[model samples]
Target: MFDFVPTRSDGDALREYAELFRASFPDAGHLNETYLKWLYSENPSGKVVGFDAYAEGRLAAHYVTVPADVFIQGVRQRGLLSLNTATHPDFQGKGLFTELARRTYERGAELGFNFVYGVANANSTPGFIRKLGFQLVRPLDAKISLGHVAKVDWPAVCRTAAFRRQWTEAHLAWRARNPQNAIRFASNRDGVLTAFASTDKPGVVVAGEFSPDGPVTALPCASVPILPRLFIGLLPEASRRRGLAIDVPKALRPSPLNLIYLSLDQKQKTLPADQIALSFLDFDAY
Candidate 1:
């Protein structure tokens, strides 16, 4: 039999949990104590939770939940951001993740969250689909519009301090980590960095970029309302053809931001089953 328990953010047990996470998701690269601390400490809404699985007195699996503020039809709604779920290699096929996820959902209900969200990759999508009954709701799409780039005011953009800081950090990180891809940022007159977008792949533009490290702030009114649209227009032509996939929110119809939708229950006949994958973000962990 296995033991499942909630973990707090202190002590050797938490340290062991962190180690297991690092080993399980190495592709995250540069995920250390500092990054995790930043995520928990700087979260604006203060909603984060964690669960750990134990077998034979050793930590074996883990999962976390984060609170996300999403906008639908101009109304802000709260969502449960499910992230960083992993099982130790030795413990695979034992249904540890499934059991823990069930518990997580129960906790989410108690906490008053309406829906759960995650970004799953190829390896774990099947389990989330077959076992957990999560459906594929959104597939990401990208489009490059060079005509929009020509209208941007580079001088005004550089003048804003907040925009400068966000641009500098985001651009440098993208260059170092994704040298081949392009990144862009936009600011309102009040100096708030209101808009950010990136192209991480050669011909793909991923918009809806934000500073992953801090809380989102309100931006000043744009002198030209179409600045955000212009930023999206700068994406490479080939990238426009190769769009990405994303999960859609339950209440909202498909738009640029919320493109996909998934249901945890299989009896609901809303979205197609085959194209979706289970997702968990690394940063959302407690």
Candidate 2:
């Protein structure tokens, strides 16, 4: 049997979260105390909401939802970004994953959040759909551009898009402090693009490009990818084919990323996949 405790943002809790994270995921070493503090505690939107399972006083499994404000149907609403989930090897077959999510979502709804969403990889898609009642919206497009990638009119795109993550200056500042790597931001007379070193490969991932203040910030970059790598977000539904970018085939990608959503209010319909615009910056892609 396991006891599920609500996750908290405190000195002891932060340490435990980081400890559990490193124990649960092989590549979670970078998510130490400092990183967890910034992620789970310092979000400008809201605090992290989730549960930690303890078995005989040992932290065995955990799941957390990062709070975010998103535009659903062009209307801004409070939402939860379904993120970090981990279970120690010994705790695997006890239904902790779904139960943790269930309780977390329950708590999220209690906190008055409108929806919960995330980018789910191929392996986790079925579990989310068949088990967790989430809709597998669409497979995110992956494109690689050795040079400049074309920019779309974001205001125009937002008008047609079914969903978009709300980005404020505060949110942008919090994201830039990520301990994982440095995000290089480039601006242009048209828009702004942010790229960071990809942990998976030897290049940078274009986080996302934005048209903010209702206008362009600085001059456009000579080339998009400063390191000449890839951009793993929406390329077709939201962007166009220009510059040196080519769509990466499914077979070539190490793993396929799919956007998934579950509305806290059952009355709200699942947002359409086709109109959703995403990028690494939108979620925990780093």
Candidate 3:
């Protein structure tokens, strides 16, 4: 029989969890105690809700939900991002993952989390939908506009998107001040600062508020698009970029990814398929 614990209590469990993760996914980045503490304990939203299953006095399976404040149509909704899940190799087909998820989500709902979302890869997408009741939102595609953005006449516009982080002054400052990673800038006369993360590849815009003429072309950019605008894309880059390839009619595409969500609320809700947009900064991927 498996005994499930609701929270992580020691460094040994973390060490074992990291070992299992490394063994299961050889290419994944190393998750040390520091990073684990930073990610699971120190997120801006809230402490992560975790579940661990032990069989015969040994840790056998694990699941966790990382909390995030999701903004939809400018309204704040408390949500959890379903993060890393792992099972011991010896306990592969015992329905442990589903069991852990069910319990964790039950706890999540009690904690006032209304939804759980994640960018699902091919291997896990089917299982999440088929077994865990996760709904497929859409197949993620890259919106790569290579040319310079056209300046709109309006001073600023409201951000429009289904799933966005509620950006505060502190978050914006942290993102803009990062020297090694993404940097926000004002590209035009209006003071809206669009965000671009400098990568090995060309700079990718992770967060930007757009108008009818499209996203702002410059930075010191408008201080937060104040009024309701026509469009917004709220995607932060997920780590496994290999799966998301966007192919327009004439453009050659890379790989592709899919978005999925598990709603904790009783009422069924769906995302706006066409308006969905995200950036590398959105997920733990980049």
Candidate 4:
């Protein structure tokens, strides 16, 4: 029998998790304690929720999800962003991931989390959808822009998307503190857009157009951009009003990312890809 306990957010525990993570993915950069602490401990949305299973006093597997608030029909509701999960090599065929996820969602529902969502890669998409009963919303589009993004209507986009991420100053700030990617921002007369230097291509800057404050009004942008290079994110239909972005070749991407969702309350929900506003900042993949 496996012993289960709530995942801890302490330094030592995070370090231990990182160790197991490194054992699975050796070249990972986000293995430092600082990154783990910021993600599981310092997130403003809420503390981490998941479980760790032990067998004979050894950690057999670990899984966790972070809390987030999403706007559904203009009302805020609790949500969980399905995140890290790892099991030792010795325990690979035991179906630990499915079991751990099932346990996590049960606790999440008890704590008022309405649903769970995540960006899954090609290899894991099957397990999430077939084994865990997640809905395949859509795949993230890969686009490349040359130092350009036309004026965007954030409020309109938010409303059209039906599922909107509630972005507060605290949550945005917490997102900017990622140790692995030094997320920067450039604010002009229009509004704030998060940016980060991309290592895949030198001199290529990935940017996300987002309104940090409320969407009461629209902001104007200068004809010029400070770090005009390439923009990568969910560019709403409004963004195409006047911009130059071409679809990036699928061959360039390591793997296609698909958005997956599961309703904890067993209520059906629809999240159209064209409507949701998402960026690398919204997920941990970057």
TM-score of each: 0.57, 0.89, 0.71, 0.89
> Which residue pairs does candidate 4 place in steric collision?
none
lDDT of 2: 0.76
Q: How many collisions between residues are there in candidate 4?
A: 0
| Model 4 RMSD, rounded to 1 decimal | 3.5
Q: Model 3, residue 260: what's the lDDT?
A: 82
lDDT of each: 0.45, 0.76, 0.61, 0.75
lDDT of 3 by residue, 1-286 (tens): 9999895725776677777777666766546554566566656677789798999887788888888766655567888878888887888999999999999999999998988888777788899999888888887654444432223322212345566655454444443443334454444345434554443344343334322123433333333223221111333232112222233432333334577888788543777664444444455543
* RMSD over all Cα atoms, model 1: 11.1
lDDT of 4 by residue, 1-286 (tens): 7888889999779888988888877877677678889899899989999999888988889999999888765567888999899998888889888899999999999998999989899999999999989998888877776655555776576656556677776776677677777566656456555445444566666676666645422222223334445544565564346667677788988888888888888654656566667777677656
Candidate 1 lDDT score relative to the true structure:
0.45
lDDT of 1 by residue, 154-267 (tens): 333233211111223322232223222223345444333433333233443333322233333432222223322212212112112233333233343223422222323222
lDDT of 1 at 286: 13
- Candidate 4 has its poorest 10 consecutive residues by lDDT at 216-225
> Residue 55 error for model 3, in Å?
1.7
- Poorest lDDT segment (10 consecutive residues) of candidate 3: 224-233
